[model samples]
Target: MKKPSRIVNFLYRLVGMSYVHESVSEVREALAEHSVGTVAERWARIHAQGAEKLQHPLDFQPGLIDLHDEMHDMWRYLVALRNQASRGMSAHLADELEEAADFMGEVLHHVGLAAEATIPDASLDRGPGSTWINIPAPPAL
Candidate 1:
């Protein structure tokens, strides 16, 4: 199968990176609010806001559907944790929260790799449509 052009790959990676950033920020906020005993209604609001924010970027990259679902699952877990804490059922939640944070870090690392892979190598010659221009330096004074 023919590989996608570098431009296409770069666009996909850029959009994916944006989605990952938004997801990470939302999860971090949710986790912080949960730790502070935020109410269930507030959690629901945050969930809706995060979903809305991610919808467009997620649509840009069809390959990330699974990741999008995983994000929702993580958000649900955070909301549940908040509910549990509110009910005085806190037990090992700190550990769970830490795990979630670690998972997000891993996701960020992977997405960063995907984005980085598309960057043009500095040592490679620019192909067709390259805009780089080399001008000879003026004679030394």
Candidate 2:
């Protein structure tokens, strides 16, 4: 694969992973900032939303998809930040940090959509296309 393709694949994978991590951490962090009581109430409401979705099929919104993309972008930006930070120059990150921060803002904006369970199969790009199967038959049946 080409370098750009590889990079894009890396970003997509990173985003999926981050989605799971952030979802779980948010509940904890939110509780830390607010109180357990308030967080518990929010959790209950979120659980109800999940149950409703399971009970009804056509109620999904575009916001959830947008949030998925934004969260993915945030993960990509974070990977970029880590790479930039490893370059060993304060000036390097200084230039890239603003963009990363902007991406982080997007993640925060779509915070509620992040899933607390397993990372969904939704990917950043069209995933690898279906592969063909090969069969070997008898030479002369």
Among all candidates shown, the one with the greatest TM-score: 2
Candidate number of the best lDDT: 2
Model 1 alpha-carbon miss at residue 104, Å: 2.3
Model 1 earns a TM-score of 0.27
Q: Give the per-residue Cα lDDT of candidate 1 at 7.
A: 82
lDDT of 1: 0.53
Model 1 over residues 34-122: C-alpha lDDT tens digits?
66654766666765654454333323233244555576567567656656665656556655665675676567567545433433463
- Span of ten consecutive residues with least summed lDDT in model 2: 132-141
Cα lDDT, all candidates = 0.53, 0.54
Model 1 misplaced regions, further than 4 Å: 1-88, 122-141
- Root-mean-square deviation of each candidate, in angstroms? 21.8, 20.7
